[model samples]
Target: MQVSSWRKAAITASFLTLAASTANAAAGPLDPTQGGAGGRIIRVTTLAKDGPGSLKEAVEAKGPRVVVFEVGGNIDLGRDVLTIAEPYLTIAGQTAPSPGITIIRGGIDLKGHDVILSHIRVMTGADGKPHFSDWEADAFSSVAAHHVLVEHCSFLWALDENMSASGPRFTGKTLAEWRANTSHDVVFRDNLAAEGLAFSSHPKGEHSKGSLIHDNATNITFYRNVFAHNVERSPLVKGGAQVLMVNNLIYDPGHRAVHYNLMNLEWTGHPYVTGEITAVGNVMRGGNSTDADLPFLTIGGDGDLKYYGQDNRAVDRFGKALPMFGRYGETKARILQQKAPLRSVTGIPVLPSGEVETSVLQTAGARPWDRAPDDIRVLFFVAEGRGEIIDDEHQVGNGYPKAAETRASFNPAAWNLDTMTPRSGRYPGDQTGPQEKLSPRDAAMRQGGV
Candidate 1:
């Protein structure tokens, strides 16, 4: 009775919160400005090298920096991984000459505190070229990092997962080490993670993953993003405390949209800890192929897991709500469907159900910096097959910037193609890299300017 009463009260409060605002509520971790260097701006200049104005150099630079781009191009990292070990950094990919700035071949690792990554595109194996390591890394990964934000980016064709938040494996370590390895206060928002892969170390048979929040990662919020075309682990919720997935658009994933589990059972070696996920105002559409009828959420492992969902919608291709089911019988399903656990989340923004679809579509990935506002509004519909694709790439003063481009198209027809093999014609958008013109400002920025 008390739980029912609590759920009713919380539902009322959530509706009231939603009614109070009809705006696109900003999501994700607080900006990197919450701490460090009082927020300084560092402009990125290089495309092919790792020196001054280069993203690699920016990662190695000390202190908090709002790392902006003055050029747009791909950085070909043969097998090198960019590691950010400093505190208080913000990679402002939005400040580039265009939204198509900074496509990376090798992946990035966020192993620091108070970091924000935005507006960049990460293509793990560019142009279907293999990495020297046989494509064994994610586009973006974190370990024990705190107060991080990843937004307005696109990650595709990763050798492993597209994006992941995790820490070290527990090898029967002490409590201090365990505590030290836990990731907390992380948020992934307004991004696109598509066509993630499964490779060595990731379960091979039935689990190619998208985003993973591994065991011991905590306080994560996934808000208003697109998770499309992955087999499993579309933001898998492993053992953690306080995870919130809200207002996300998951379209056509090959398996369950969200999995609550100890993902890698062999590696975790656990007296498994309980994991919690609170889902709200989210949407999922089953794939057009064999995965069309999969469950939206699944509970795996025997851990004491908790799922509290409210005001969520799942649809098929025809816009019909899909059946929501629990793996266990009625009693377990009732607990998973309740809304009481999310009442404790106060002060965070609550998104209304109506706003989620448009918000996610219009702002999910990189957009042109100077395109008309109206065009930007309609771009998602065009990308989903309404109008013709626009050409925005341009030549700087005399010549084009020398960055690699994916130049791929969005092909929903290829959703069922086996991504495991090395065929380039799989997903929508650029399969190799982004194909946008370098901003004219790139010339000024590249000449030791800006």
Candidate 2:
């Protein structure tokens, strides 16, 4: 068929537009003296003693510009860099992508609007003194801030002293204490977190709310991110509230992987509210003793299991079911294959016959748990590989089929000592398998194996 005139014209227009846009971005930094230039670029370096202040001043003076923190070498946060003063600024790390600008002493207290923190690391207080204590509130606390985007970053090591009071108190109780402050429209995507060190605390009432936490913040999506060696008294979310917890690798040194009160949609006395919480496509592992009352997923009270979905799953570093909750909605979740032979969570390979293998392992690594749980179920996609399901009682080979062909369902009631056999299928043989079983590690691996 002959090409039409409209097609030719459209192709020409698209090429010209792309060329013009490329030219504009490549024009280098704008002249400071020029008016109406709009966007300006600011750089931060550790070479100078006055690096943080100088960079902050430049950002404030530039007015509505992108402030790029360019580190000459790897630098740790001496004190808190970029305090609560500068708001509405897009901050990005340059020397390296994530774990580049490590916040050792203090967190980036976000109280402003439209703040974007990308490719940075928010670490715990590196005081050089090892103690069993949690960090003060949040490493990056956004108190009443709006429209904040935290992408490609890492939040690790928020340990509290074991002797500290259990349960939620108020400010400064523990790192979890900081989450009590309300913040809205916060997006945490493509980030990694580990609960470093060891501390103990208890779960309290309703805390942080209104946030969209996912892995696919950018165009290229990943499977799961790993979080190991973290300890906590109780679960992250309490009471009935809406939060997006997906594609994450969570491990526990002492406490359960996840603990939350299930919202009872039918009960009048229960404070259960209809919330939209999606726990899909994540890998949870770790914790000692398989039969430690660790529900691969647990929800407290008579709450509802509203959309509790887990597919293509794996155990923690210790081979225990990654703990989870929210049974308000009884919709059966998709369980994927765990032994898909191939590595790599995202980017499954295409075969010579034009077939794509989707059973690739997204996350693979050592067990985070000091002791592995007794009953653990690992779900894998058929395209990745075929394997047997093992529990306390027996082992079943080729139990569930791969997502590329068939659908797998999880029965919490029937998930005892019986191993389920995986259904056989075809998968691409080229892609590598997941590097780590934990979500955070798997997530980091996908992004060039951190």
Q: Which candidate is the best by TM-score?
A: 1
Question: Over the full model, what C-alpha lDDT does candidate 2 score relative to the true structure?
Answer: 0.34
Question: Candidate 1 on 262-370: residue-level lDDT in tens?
Answer: 5444434555555678888887766543155567777665555677888778777666677654342222222245548553445556576655665555446544223
Worst 10 residues of 1 by lDDT: 388-397
Give the distance in Å from residue 167's predicted Cα in candidate 2 to where it truly belongs: 18
- How much is 41 displaced in model 2, in angstroms? 1.3
Model 2 RMSD in angstroms:
18.6
| Number of clashing pairs per prediction, in order | 11, 79
Encode model 2's per-residue lDDT on 1-450: one tens digit a residue.
Answer: 332232232234332221111101222121011111234555564423244534445445535555544342223444444454445566544222222344444445556656555445544433443232233334454554545655445554332211011122123343233333334445444344433333221122111111112111111122233344344322243433334444554443234444444333423443333223445455544444223434445444443434345352445444444444323234332222223322222322111111111111121111111001110122231222222211211122231111121112222232110111011110111112322234687678778779
lDDT of 2 at 53: 33
TM-scores for the candidates: 0.70, 0.48
